[model samples]
Target chain A: MRAAAQVFDEYGLAGSSISKIMTRAGTTQGAMYFHFKSKENLARAVINEQAADLSLPERPEGLAQLIGLTFFLAREMQSNVLFRAGVTLAVEQGQVGLRDFSPYDMWADLFRGELEAARSKGELQDDVDVAEVAQLLVAAYTGSQVMSNLLTGPDRADLPERIGRMWRYVLPGIAQPDRLAELREVAERTGPAA
Target chain B: MRAAAQVFDEYGLAGSSISKIMTRAGTTQGAMYFHFKSKENLARAVINEQAADLSLPERPEGLAQLIGLTFFLAREMQSNVLFRAGVTLAVEQGQVGLRDFSPYDMWADLFRGELEAARSKGELQDDVDVAEVAQLLVAAYTGSQVMSNLLTGPDRADLPERIGRMWRYVLPGIAQPDRLAELREVAERTGPAA
Candidate 1:
């Protein structure tokens, strides 16, 4: 999967060949074919795996952990060269083919659940449209990273700071200030990087 | 230029060969090459032409026009297949080769100029970070259109409504309430679709 992702990222999906991926995997064609029937199937598996890597489980106990995870994922997304390669493949796809948007649906569902928990706990504005807010935030966060990719290219120097600012602006609007203060305190106490 | 744009729109940049564009324009290679050296040059020319079409003048009078233009462009971007062609080319180029981002820079400059005018005219907040606001709005507007392009493949049924709602929400915070009310009246009078 990593080998395929690397090839797919270096050259776009259309440009990458199955033979090239097989060679990179250091495996025979039979082995590769046994795993994934076609080139597209292999590509789909790479995408599904990358999505799984980023996906987090249900967390009702800690909003801070949720925020920290998003921050970590963003950092990893910008730093990990393999992930960047996967991103290139995804961008090349550009929503051109593949009918299954189940990953997006799943992430959205998970995100909505998180926001709903916050609302139920009285940690957000009573009037806050949780779903809309969650949707907009997701859009802004993901879309901004794409922007970062375009502007910064392979050297994503400004990503961390930009994401830092995003969280600062976004968390203030959504988080209950007192609870957020405690979370910040915890993060600070944990470490400098945290 | 329009012919070239049409060619690119109907068939993607790579697909729309120079010969095809020349055929569309009813001109020979010599004439086309006299103005543009290659297909890339022609694509640059078409992009430049779009920039010229969107020139807001060194001095623009209408505050509402500035905001309206953005809203209008966002909707146009979503609905028009031709618009997607440009986005696709730009994004694709960014991933592989360095895209001719000069056109985007030109548009950003024009957008910033209008924002400065609005600020000086006391239409926008004096403390408003015009650079941030301009880029933020452009990024969100462009980014959302990209998302819609991905999700819906340019059918664009809810695009105007979505952008309109986003505009209504953000514009109020930036624009004076009286100005917003005035614009609201004008919008109602025109009875334009969202």
Candidate 2:
């Protein structure tokens, strides 16, 4: 799976091949087939197992926890090849056959959980739309990492910092007026996992 | 150029070939080489000319103009083959050779222009960081479009609406407290070019 992810990450779905993946993994055809049946199946397995290994930090403030989750994901993207590969596949899935699952939808579902908690705790403003904000954040983070990686490579110095700034731009509209400043500060304090 | 852009948009840089481009363009090798020396050179030309044909609307409010430009771009991505191809090349440049010109950088520069104008006009908050905001917006929009394309292709219904919501969330932080309400209304007014 790691080898397949690397090949998919470097070359998109159309460019990737089973021969390249097998060569990278250093495994025989029979051995590979015994584990995974086809390239599409392997790609789907990679997408499904993207978040299987990591743990998320728990912050008392739900909004802060949400920010921390993204910060952590950004850090993981820099270091974890499997995570990076899943992201690359999810973004370019339109050009490939693996359209059954969307990483964006999963991320948004996770965000909605935190956002609802923040709202119940009175951290969010009355009119803040949770679903819309979740969608925007998911998209923003997705695009930011792609652009950051494209411009500066995976282990970028500014990926976490950029996400921090993204929360700064978003919190004012979502956070309660009294807690806006505090939330912005907390967002900054989520710090660079770099 | 349009043919090349279409091929690149469908298949990324690594997957695209000169033969496919020429066949799509319905041109002979002599005609093609007479204009572009190599595939890389032609790709670079497409990248540089990505925004050359776009003419952003001249709204009186600079912030509104910025929103208008993005909304315009979202709509164009659905209909304009060249634009979509350029965006694909810019995002996936890491997988290929055309790394010199970044679409994100060009977008940030354009956003900075509008942001500077808004700041000078006192429409923005005193502490608003124009460059950082520019970067965030560029990333946010890039990711949003990729997701939109993935989910519903370029002509998606909710893309412009999503972008509208993005500015609504962001403007509260960037706009002066006095103009926040007015700016939100203007943001909604920007609408989708569709």
Candidate 3:
């Protein structure tokens, strides 16, 4: 799986091959077939397990935690090969003739859950639709990563900063008036360390 | 070019073949090579001409015009096959082993020009970073379009609405205090017709 992730990350789904992954893994074709059955299955597994290594520090489940989660993800995209590979595959899945949107859907649901918690705690504005905001965040983050990766290279060195800027721009429109300042601060301060 | 766009849009760069494009275009391979020596060259041409069909109304060149441009793009993404194909190729260029960042850079420059005008007119907040906001807007718009296409299908039925929501969410963070409401109103009102 690790080898597959590395291969997919560098070459993308259409460019990756089972033979290349097998060579990288130092495994026989028969063993590879026994494990993954097909390259598509292996790719899907990578996508599903993209977040398996995420170790976010436990934070209260609300807006702050959500902000922390994004910061953590931005950091991960910079250094984590597996996670970055999964994101690349997901974005380029159309080229692979795969329409799997589960990764995007899962992120949207997770963000929605956080926003719902924020709403319950009066951290969100009354007019803020939790689902819409959640979806927007996911899309915005996805785009930010892509742009950062394209402009800043595969390391995505500036993704964390871009994400911080994104939160600063978005929070005032959705966070409760009195909580906006605090939320912006949280977005700024919550990073890999937090 | 139209045939090439359709083929590239549907099959992407790696999946598309010169013969296939020729078949679709009803042209000889010799003729095709006369215009484009390689698939990569053709893909780049498509990306460069992505906005060739855009005919946005002449609006004062500032934030409102920028907002109108995004709205127009949202609507175009739904119906313009050539435009959609160019975007898909640009995003999926990695699959074709192409690293052209010109398209994205062009967009950022276009957006930055409008934002700079907005700043000169005091439509933006004093603390706003024009270049950063322009880059953020481009990234946000790209992500919104990808998500809308993914969730709402290839037709991207809700793309215009998503773009509108994006503007509403982002404007509050950078627009001048008094201009916020008017800017948002412009965002809401500026659409396909305008």
Candidate 4:
């Protein structure tokens, strides 16, 4: 799985081949076939397990936790190859004709849960729709990472800062007026410093 | 060019072959080679000319015009195959190891210019940074379309509405309080019926 992730990361799904991955993994074809039937299956496994390495320390659930989650992802994207490869494959999956949207759906649900908690605690505005905002956050985060990859390189060095800027622009529209300043401060802080 | 756009759109850069493009174009290899020496060159042409067909009618330059431009793009992404093809290739270019960022840079600059105009007209708050907002807009718009494509499909039927939602969430962070309601109304409206 790790070797496949590396190959998929560097060459993308369409550009990656079983032979290349097998060579990189130093495994025989028969053994590789025994474990995974096809390249697509390997790719899917990588996509499904993308969040395995994304460990966030325990924190209160609400808008601040949501902000912290995004920050953690931004930092992970820079440092974790397997996680980064999964993201790269997800974005490039269309090229290989793979349309599995489970990752996106899973993320939206996770964010919606966070937003719902925020609303329950009076951190969110009364009229804010948690589901729609959750979907939008997923989309915005996806695009921000892609743009960072293109403009800043594969390392995505500026993603954390970019996400911070995103929160500053988005928080005012959803969060309660009283929580705005503190939430914006939370959004601006980089890494797991909290 | 149209045939190449269609082929690139469906197959992406890596999966697309010179022979497939030649067959799609219904032209001799010599003729195709005469215009574009390589597949990379053809892909570059498509990327560079992605916005050639994005025509916006006469509108006052400010926040409204910026909003109008995004709407126009959303509508185009639905009906215009060539335009959609260009966008698909741009997003999928990294799969083929092509990292040309001129398309993204062009978009950021174009958005930044509109934002500068908006700031000058007092449509934006005094503390807002036009350049950062402009880049964020580009990133958000890019992500929104990708998510729409993934969740909604290639036609992107919901993109205009989604972009409208984005503006609603973002405007409050930068726009003057007096302009919020009017801009939010403008953002919610679909199509080019101004």
Using TM-score as the measure, the top candidate is 4
Give per-residue CA lDDT, model 3, range A44-109, as digits (tens).
888888888777544347899999889888988988988999888788776656677789988888
Error of 4 at A159 (Å): 0.7
Tens-digit lDDT track of model 3 for B32-86: 9999998888888888899788775443378988998888888888889889988
Indicate the fraction of true inter-chain contacts that candidate 2 also forms.
0.63
In model 4, state the lDDT of residue B127.
Answer: 82
Candidate 4 residue spans exceeding 4 A from truth:
A56-60, A191-194, B57-60, B191-194
TM-scores of the candidates, chain A only:
0.77, 0.88, 0.93, 0.92
The residue-by-residue lDDT of candidate 1 on A1-194, one tens digit each, is: 88887787666665677899989989998898889877778667775566554546657533555466556656767656466565454445542355344434454566677778777777765545666655554555555555566676654545554445444434544667667676545434332255
Q: Estimate each model's TM-score.
A: 0.76, 0.91, 0.93, 0.94
In model 4, state the lDDT of residue A174: 94
Candidate 1 lDDT by residue in tens digits, B22-138: 898899888988988777776666655554444345565445666666666655565454454565556555433444655555556667777777777777755456655555555
- Taking chain B only, the TM-score of every model is 0.74, 0.88, 0.91, 0.91
Interface RMSD for candidates 1 onward, in order: 4.0, 2.6, 1.4, 1.5
Task: Give the C-alpha miss distance for residue A54 in model 1, angstroms.
Answer: 3.0
Candidate 2 at residue A136, lDDT? Answer: 91
* Tens-place lDDT digits, model 2, residues B1-194: 88888887776675688899999999999999998877786687778788766776544357878877888887777777787777766665554445553567878988998999998899888888999999999888888877777677555556787788898898888898998888777777777533
Candidate 4's clash total is 0
Which whole-number lDDT from 0 to 100 does residue A63 have in model 2? 89
TM-score of 3: 0.93
Model 1 reaches what TM-score against the true structure? 0.76
